[model samples]
Target: MSVETDSHGRLYLSSELRQKYGEKFHIVEYEDRLELVPIDEDPLQAVREAAGDAFEGESIEELRERAREQAKEDAEAGFERGKRTAEGGNE
Candidate 1:
């Protein structure tokens, strides 16, 4: 179906289209065209779907602890790498 924008350059979707797709959309613009992508209304559910089983049996507290430990390890590794770089080491 063909759609047109108003004088203000705003396009309106028909109720049929809205019901078929969604109320919320992300407009992607290419050099020569525009496309609309439907967005999930429930953002947390979307994240859960995308994450899949990555967090499987882990509790929130366990995840937080793991994140903190990983951050500390990353900081220490970065510091050691910087030290070695400053000392002209290949490590």
Candidate 2:
């Protein structure tokens, strides 16, 4: 199928396409081309499916704590990486 953008540069997908692929999409742009990735209609369900068995026996509080710790660790690692990059390190 062929698609064209309007003067406002907004491209509208056909209903047929929308039915096949969801109503929402993630537009990915590369140096050469663009791609439209369909997004999950129910993101929480997708997360649960993806996270199978990882947090099977964990309580809500335990999950929250783990999330917090992971976020902190990720932030610290990012900060360290940024610092090294700024200090002329290739890391």
Q: Residue 72 in model 2: shift from native, Å?
A: 3.5
What's the TM-score of every candidate structure? Answer: 0.56, 0.61
Per-residue lDDT of candidate 1, residues 1-91 (tens digit): 8889999998899999988988999999999999999998887567767999887888779988999999999999999999999999977
Residue-level lDDT tens digits of model 2 in 9-78: 9999888888998789899999999999999999756777899977787777998999999999999999
Identify the runs in model 2 with alpha carbons over 4 angstroms from their true place. 57-62, 73-91
- Considering every candidate listed, which one attains the maximal TM-score? 2
The 10-residue segment with the lowest total lDDT in model 2: 40-49
Candidate 1 scores a C-alpha RMSD against the true structure in Å of 3.6
Model 1 poorest ten-residue lDDT run: 40-49
RMSD of each: 3.6, 4.8
